[model samples]
Target: MNTKWWKEAVVYEIYPISFKDSNGDGIGDLRGIISKLDYLQNLGVDVIWMCPIYQSPGQDNGYDISDHYGIKPQFGTMHDFDELLKEAHARGLKIMMDLVLNHTSDQHPWFIESKSSKSSPKRDYYIWRDSKKGLSPNNWESYFGGSVWEPDEKTGQSYLHLYSKYQPDLNWQNEEMIHELYKMIRWWLKKGVDGFRFDAIAHIVKAKGLPDADNPKHLPVVQAYQFFSNLEHVHTLLRKLNEEVLMECDIMTVGETSGLGPEQALEYVGDERHELNMVFQFEHMTLDSPSTGTSRWESRSWTLLELKKIMSRWQTTLHNKGWNANYLGNHDQPRQVSRFGNDTEYRVESAKMLATFFLTLEGTPYIYQGEEIGMTNASFQQIGDYRDIETLNFFELAKTKQMPEDKTMAAIHAKSRDNARTPMQWDASEHAGFSDAEPWIKVNDNYKDINVEAAIQDPDSIYHYYRKLLALRKQHKVIVYGEYKLMLPLDPDLYVYTRTLAEECLLVILNFSHDTIEFEWPDQLAYEARELLIGNYEEVPEERKEGMLLRPYEARVYMF
Candidate 1:
C-alpha cells in the first residue's frame, strides 16, 4: 500500500449551518467551528472537511456560489476565517473547504454578465442555447426537480442548470472561465488551505449538443445522470486542474462523483489519472433508494446482501487502483443511525457496530458531525419545519399530484435532507444547547437523551467508542493500509471482515440484527483470539462447537 498522509488520516465532515451557533443568531459560523476545535482535536480526527462557507444567496444551502473569493457574511468575515485556519493548523488539524466549481448562483457576477445579453463577452461562460420548438432547449430535468433549462428572457435564450434554476452550470469548454477558476484555486492554496472537496464534479461536463435522455419518463436522478455525469471530458478538465493547480501543493482533493461504477470511478481517482485523491461515491448510500426510474423519496426495503455487494466491489476495485472515502451519512443524506440501524431500540450499540464496520475497513473513514454521539433523524412533524430546498420542492410537487399528505410526510421523514441537517445537540438544555435562540432548523426531538454532554459523561457512549476505535486505527497501520476480504457474504444477520497486512491482521465481526444469532466461524478464519482490541460489550463471549452467540448490535475487533 502507498504511504500517503491523506490515506492515513481520518476525516470529519462538518455541515457548518447546523454545527454550532456562536453568537446565538441561530446560525453556525466560522467562530462556532473555531470554538469546537479542541473538542474535535480531542476526538482524534485529523482533517475537518467543512461544507461551503463561500458567499452565496443562501439557495440550496450554500451550494450556490455567488462569490468564489468571498466568505458568506452569515458564516463570518475573512478575518474570522483566517483566525479559524490559523487555530485549526495550530491544533494539528487540516481544513478542507467545499469547492462548488461545477456551477455558480445566478446572482454571481459571471452569471449575471452572462445573462445580460447574447452579445455580452461573458455570454459563453455559461451553457446557453436558443429555444427548441419554443420550449426548453433540451428535455432534461433539474436534480432538485423541475426543468434543467431555465429560460433567460433577456437574451431570448435558455441556460442550463443541473441543480436549482438559480444556479447555472459553468461552461468548462470556455478557456477563459477555466483560467479564472484555476487562478481562484491557486489563490486559496496560497492562503494556506489544506484541501478541497469538489462538489458535483462529475456534472461539470455535459454531453455535446445538449442531448436528451433516452427515457424522459425516468426520474431526473437516473435519466439526467446518464446524459450529464462522469463524462470523458471531465477527466480532461481534472487533469488540467491537477497539473495547473493541485500538483503545486501537497493537499487532499476529493470529488463528489455520482453515477460511477468502479470502472468509471478509476478514471477520476486512479493514481496515474492525476484527477483526485479519492471520491465520494453514491452506490452504497442508495441501497434503500428504489430503482433508477423511481424517486429516492419513494423508498423500499434494502438487504445486507445488496450493501455488501456494493461495498465489497468498491473495496476490492479501488484497493490498488485508486483510493476510497468511506461514509454512510453526510449533509445530503438521512442520519446513518436511523437509516441503517435500529434507532428505536439499539441506537448506541448499532451506531458503534457501524463505526467499527467502516473504520476498520481498508479505506479512510469519514465521520459526519453529530454521528459520534449517535444522533438520529430529525423527524419533524410539519412541512413548514423543513429547511432543505430539495425536500420542499418534492413536497410541493407531491401536493399538486394529489399524493396523500401523510404519504408525503412519511417520505420526508424517511428521506428528507433536513433529517440530517438538524442543529447539533451540544447539551440537554434548550435548543439542544446549539443556540440561545431558535435554530434555523428544528433540533431532533431525542436530543435530550442523546446530547453530547450526556454522552461524554457516559464512558460507554458512542462518542467514546469512536475515540477508542480511532485510537486503535491510528496505532495499527493494517486498518488503513491492509488488504480487505469480506467473510460470510451471505449472512443476513452478521457482517464479518478481516483487514490484513503482512504480519498483522485484525478481524472485525458485527451483528447487524436485533436478535441473538450464532455465527459459525469459517475454517480459514478460525483462530483463538489473542487480544480483544475493542468491543461494544464488556467481554468477548465464548464460542461453542457451532460458533459464538452474537448479541444484538454487538461489535468486536480482535487480533490474533
Candidate 2:
C-alpha cells in the first residue's frame, strides 16, 4: 500500500483554554499557543489538532459555536489565530481546527431567528416540533440529562438538543443550512487550514420522517440518540461533503463518531469513498461504561483481554480498508498515566510502555499536551474546585439523588472532566509555572517531579523516550507502513506484536504486568536478536539462551 503523508504523521492535540495564558488573564489563548509552538516542534509532532476556538456561550465549552467565521474574543481575534497558523506552518507543522457543526449555541443568529415564529424560514433550520399529548414531541434524552426537547416559551413548541439545552441540534435535512455550512468550511479552507477535527460528525442525520425511536428500556426522554446515530442517509450526506469540500482541498479530515462499529467505520473512510480521511471510533474509549448510563469509577476494573480485544478488532478491521486516529488520552479524557497505569509507583516505565503500545500500532498517533512528561490527573478535593459544566451537572445529580457526600466526592475525584482541564505544568514553581496569575484550574500536586523542566533536562526521562519513539516512526518505513501481527497472543502479562514491510521486520514486546516474566520465543523468532532499537528498561541481554526475559512493565523493540 502506498503511504499518504497523514498515514505516518504524529498529531498533538491542544486544549487552548488550558495550554498557556500569555497575558496573565488566567485563561489560555491563541497567543499562548503561539508561544508554545517551539515546544511542540521540539517534541517532534508533525501536526497540531486544536480544540474549538469559535465564538460560543461556552455551555459545552467551545463546542457550542455561535459563529463559524470569527474567533471567540476570549481566545483572541481572527488576526491572532491567523498569526498562530502562519507560525505553525513556518515551523513545518500542519494545523487542524475543531469543526463543531453537529450543534450551535442557542444564542446563534439562526437559532434566535428560528425560535421567533412558525412561519419564519429559519424555523426549519433547527428541529422544532409541536407538543403531542400535552408533552414533549418525542421521547428523547439529552446527553447531559433530562428531556432532549426543551419547550420554547415564545413559540409554545419544543426544540431538540442531544446535549445541553443551550446547544440545539441542527437540521441537516435543511438544504439551505447545509449550503451555509459548506460555505463556512470553504472560507476556513481559503484561510489555509490543513484540515478539520470534525466534532460529533456521525449525529448529523436524524431518523427520516422524524419517527420515534423503538427503545424498550431507558427513560422516555433517553431515546433521542437512537433516533439519529448512524442513520441510513448519513453516509450519503458525508460523501457529498467529502466530494464538494474535503477531497478537493487535499486535507486530512477526522470524524468524532460514536456508536459506530469497525465495519461501518471502514465504510466512512474506505479508499473508494469520499467521506473522511479517518474516523475516531469510541469502541475502545467506551469499554468502561455502558451505552445507557455512566459507570461508577470505583466499580470499574479493566482487564487486559478487554483492552486487547477492543484495539485488536479495530486495528485488524481498518488495516486494509481505511485509517485510524490512535489515541489513549485527549482533552476530554483523564491523563493516561493516571487512568491506565499506576501513576503512584511506575509512572515513567508504564508511560513508556503505553507510548510503545500506541505508536507502534498501524495508525496516526495523537499526543495530548503534557503527555510526554507523564502528567497524572489533577486531584480536586472539593466539588467547588471543578469548572467543567458536565462535572458540575453530574455532581448536582448525585446530590439530588441523595447519594453519600463522600462517595460522590470520590466518584468526582476519579471521573471528573476537570482532571484533564487543569493548566499545563511547565515547572515546579507556583501554579506550576503555567502563568504569573492564578491558573484557571489547580495544577497536579506532584508537579515538583513530573513538570516539563525536570523531564526535559534528564536524558532518561519519559520526554526523551517519546522523542526516540517518534524519531523511529519518522525515519523507519517498516515502523510507519508495515503490516501489524500480534505475538504471544494469549499471555496475560505480555503484549507483543511485529511490524513487517518488504525486507524489514521489527518486533515490539511489552510486559504489562507488575512482576517480571520470561518468554521463550518460538522457532521462527528464536535466532539471536541483533538490533535492540528501543527498550523501556536497561539494555537488552547479550544471550538469547532462554529466549528473552523482561522486568515488570518493561517494553522492548528489536530488529534482526
Candidate 3:
C-alpha cells in the first residue's frame, strides 16, 4: 500500500449552509469558514471537505449546480473563495470541494438548451427520450419520490433525474459533455483546490438501454441502482480524469460509492488503479436502515454484531488492496451522536465511544462540522418545519398512500436530511451565536447545552477528546498504517479491534450499550504489557489485575 498524506490525515466536512453565518444572512458562506479557520486548526484536522458552494438553484441545497465555474452569490464572490483558499493553505490545511458531475440544475444553460427542442445543439447534453406509451422511459424511481423521468412539454420528451426534478442527469455518453466537464475540473485545480469529493459518481453510467429493475421498492417505480452502479466504463472515465486532471497535480480524490460492497470498492481505489485516492462506502451507513422498504425514513433497529460485521468486513477486505474513508455520518444523514450513540442519558460518554470507533480504525476519518462538540439531531414536530425537497416530497407521497400522518411525520423527524442541516451551535446565544438573525433552518434545541463555547472551556469535553485522538494518530504510526484484526467479532455488547504494525499494536475496545459489560482478556494477548493511551473515563482505573469491567458507553485505547 502506498503511504500518502491523505492516508494519514483527518478530514473535516463542512455543510456550508449550517456551518456558520456571516453578515447575518442566515446562511453560511466562505467568509464564515475563514472566520473559523482557527477553530478547525485547533481540532487537529488536516483537510476540510466542504459541501458544494457552486452557483445553484438551491432546490437540493446546492447539489443542483447551475454554474460550475462560479460561486453562489449567497456564499460570497470569487474573491471571498480565493481568500478562504489562501487562509486555509496558510494554516497548512487543504480544501476539498464537492464535485457534482452526475447531474446539473435544470436551470443550467446546457439543460435549458437541451430542453428547448430536440434539434438544439445541446440536445444531447442531457438524457432525453420520447415517452413509452405515455409512460416514463423506464421503471426507475427518483431518490426523492415519483418517476425519475420528468416530462418536458416543449420538447415532448422526458429528462432523467435520479434525484430531484430540478436536477437533470447529464449524458456521460456525449463526448462534448465529458470534454466540458474535464475543462471545468481543470479550472478548479488550477485555482488551488487540494482535492474533490465526487458526488454520486457511481450513477454516471446507466446500463445499456436503461433496463428495468427487479422492483425492490414494490411500488410502481423500482430501485434501478443495479443497472447504474459499478458500470465498466466508469473506471475508464475516472482513469481518463486521473490522467488528464488529477495526476497533473498532487490532489486527492474520493468518490461517493453507493450500493457497493468491499469487493466492488477495490476496483475504484485499488493501489494498482489510477482512479481515486479513496472511496466512501455506504454499507455501514445503511446498517440501521430497513433492508426491504420503499423508503429509509422509517425507524429501524440495528445491533452491535451487525455494525461490527460490516465495519470489520471493510477494514479487513480493503487493508491491502485499497483505502477506506471512515465516517459515521455526513450531510445527507442524521447526526452521528444521535444515531449511533446514546444521545439521551449517556450522551457524552457514547459520543466519545463512537469517536473512538472511527478515529482508531485504519482509515482516513472525517469529522463532520459540530460533531466534535457532540451536536445532535434537530427536533422538529411537524412536516412543515422541513425545507429539504426530499422530505417534503416524501410527506406528500405518504399522504397520497393514505399512510398515517403522525407516523410519516415521526419518521421524518427521525431520519430527514434536515436533521443534519441545522445551523452550527457556536455559543449559547439566541441563534447558537451562529448569526444575530434567525437561521435559514431552526437551530437544534440542544445547542444551549452543546456548543463550541462550552466544549472549549472544559478540558475533558468531546472536543478535547477528539483532539487527543487526532494527536494520537499523528504520534503513532501503527494507527495509520497498521493491519487490522477484529477481536470479539461475535460480541453483542462490545466492539474490540487491534491494529498492528511490526512490533507495535493498539487495542481499541468500545462498550455500545447502557449497561456495564464484563470482558475477559484474551489468552493470545499479553495483559500487563499494555499501557492505557486514552479513554472516555475521567480517570484511568488503577488496577489491571483481572478481567476488564467496562462502564456504560466507556471506550479505552491501549498501546502495547
Candidate 4:
C-alpha cells in the first residue's frame, strides 16, 4: 500500500456556512474557521476539508458558483482565506477546497453570454439545444425534480441543468472552457492551497445522444443518475484533469462519484490510473432509503447482514487496487448516529461503535462537523424550518403527488437534507453558542446537551473517544496499511473485523444492537489479546475466553 501524507490522514469536513459565526452574522466565515483551528488541531485530524467558499448566488448554498477566483462576501474576503491557509499549514493541517466543476451559477459570466443569443461567441460554453417537438430536448430530469432542460427565452433554446435551474451544466466538450478551468486550478495551487474535493464529478460526462433514463417514470429524478453518471468519457476527462493541473502539484484529490459499484470505482481510483486518490460512493448511504421511485423521504428498516455485505465488499475489493474514503454522513446526508445508530438509548455507545468500525477500516476516515460530539438530526416541526433547496423542492414534489400534508411533512422530517445543514452547536448558550444574532437556519434543539463545550469537559465524552481514535491511526501504521477481513460476516447484529499487517493483528468487535450479545472467540488464531487499545465501556473484561458477553453498543479494539 502507498504511504502518502493523505493516505495516513484523518479528514474533518466543515460546512463553512454553519460551522461558526465569528462576526455574529449568522453565517460561518473563513474567520470563524480560523478561530477554531486550535480545537481541530487538538482533535488530531490531519486534513480539514472546507466546503465551497467561493463567490455564489446562494441559490443552492455555495454550490452555485458565480466566480471561482473570488471569495464570497458572506464567507469573508480573499485576505481572510489567505490567512486561513497560512494558519492551518502552521498548525500541521492541510486544507482541501470543494471544487464545483460540473455546473456554474446561471448568473456566471459565461452562462450569461451563452444565453444572450445563439450567435454569441460563448454559446458553446454551456450545453444548449433547441426545443424538440415543443418539449425538452430529451426526457432527462433534474436531480432536484422536473425536467433537466430550462427554456432560454432570448435564444429560443433550452439549457441543460441536471440540478437546480440556477446551476447550469457546463460543457466539458468545449476545449476553451477546460483550458480556463485548469488555469483557475493552477492559480489556487500557486496560492498554496493543498487540494480539492471535486463535486458531482460522476455527472460531468453525459451518455452519448443525451439518452433518456430507463423507466424514468418509475424512479425519482435523483435516482435517474443512470442517465448522466459513470458514462464512457468520464475516465478520459479525469485523466486529462490529472495531467493538466493535478500532476503539477503534490496534493490530494477525492471525487464525489455516484452510481458507481466496487468494480467501476477501482477504474477511477486505481493507484496507477492517474485519476483521483479516492471517490465517495452512495450505495451505503441509500441502504435504508426505500426502493420507491418517487419518494426518498420514507425510510425502510435495513438488516445488519445487508450493511455488512455492502461494507465488506468495498473493503475487500479495494484492498489492493485503490483507497477508500470511509464516511457515514456529510453535508448532503442526515446525521450518522441518528440514521444508523440508536441516537436515543445508546447514542454514545453506538456512535463509538460506528467510529471503531470505520476508523479502523483500511481507509482514510472523514469526520463531519459535530459528529465527534454525537450531533443528531434536526427535529424540525414545520417545513418552513428547512433552508436546503433540495428539501424544499422535494416537499413541493410530494404535494404535487397528492400526498397528505402530514405524511409529506413526516417524510421531510425524516430525510430532509436540512437535517445536516443546521448550525453547529459550540456551547450551551443561545443558538447553541453558534451566534448571538439569529442564525440563518435553526439550530438543533439538543445542542444544549450535545455541545462541544460539554463534550470537551467530560473525559468519557464522544469527543474524547474520537480524539483517541484519531491518535491511534497516527500512532499505528497497521490501521492505515493493514489488510482487512470480515469476521462473523453473517451475524445479524454483531459486526466483527480484523486488520493484519505482517505479524501484528488487531480485532475490532462492535455490537450494534440495543441488547447484550455473546461473542464466541475464533479458534483459527487462538492467541491472547496484548492490549485493549480502546473501548466505550467503563470496564472491558480483560479475560480472553470463549463466548465473551458484549454489552449493548459495545465497541472494542483489541491488539494481539
Top of the candidates by lDDT: 3
Record all residue pairs in model 4 with backbone atoms less than 3 Å apart, i.e. clashing: none
Best by TM-score: 3
RMSD of each: 1.5, 1.7, 1.2, 1.5
TM agreement with the true structure for every prediction = 0.98, 0.96, 0.98, 0.98
* Residue 439 local lDDT, model 1: 90
Tell me the lDDT of model 3 at 381.
85
Q: Model 3, 1-560: lDDT tens per residue?
A: 46899999899999998898888889888899999999999999999999999999899999999999899999999999999999999999999999999999999999988888899999999999889999888898788877899998887899999999999999999999999999999999999999999999989998889977787546678877788888989999999989887899988889998988888999998888989989999987887788976578866899999999899889999998889999998999988988999888998999999999999898899999888999888869867678999889888989898999888887887788998899999999999999888888889888889999999999999999999999999999999999999899888999999999989989898999999898777676788897889999997655455667899999999898
Clashing pairs in 2: 140-221, 141-221
Q: Which stretches of candidate 2 lie over 4 Å from their true place?
A: 214-218, 290-299, 539-543
In the range 135-184, model 2's lDDT, one tens digit per residue, is: 88877666677778899898889998888999999999899999999999
Clashes of each: 0, 2, 0, 0
After TM-score superposition, what is the CA distance of residue 208 in candidate 2 from its true location, in Å? 2.2
- The candidate with the higher TM-score, 1 or 2, is 1
Give one digit per residue, the lDDT tens place, for model 1 in 228-345.
8888898999998999899999999999998788878899888899999999989887788877535779888888888888998998998988998899899999999999998988
Clashing pairs in 3: none
Residue 546 shift from truth in candidate 3, angstroms: 2.6
lDDT of 4 by residue, 452-549 (tens): 99999999999999999999988888899899999998899899988999888888899989998888887765656457789988786545466578
Off by over 4 Å in 3: 215-219
* Global lDDT of model 4: 0.89
Candidate 4's displacement at residue 458, Å, is 0.3
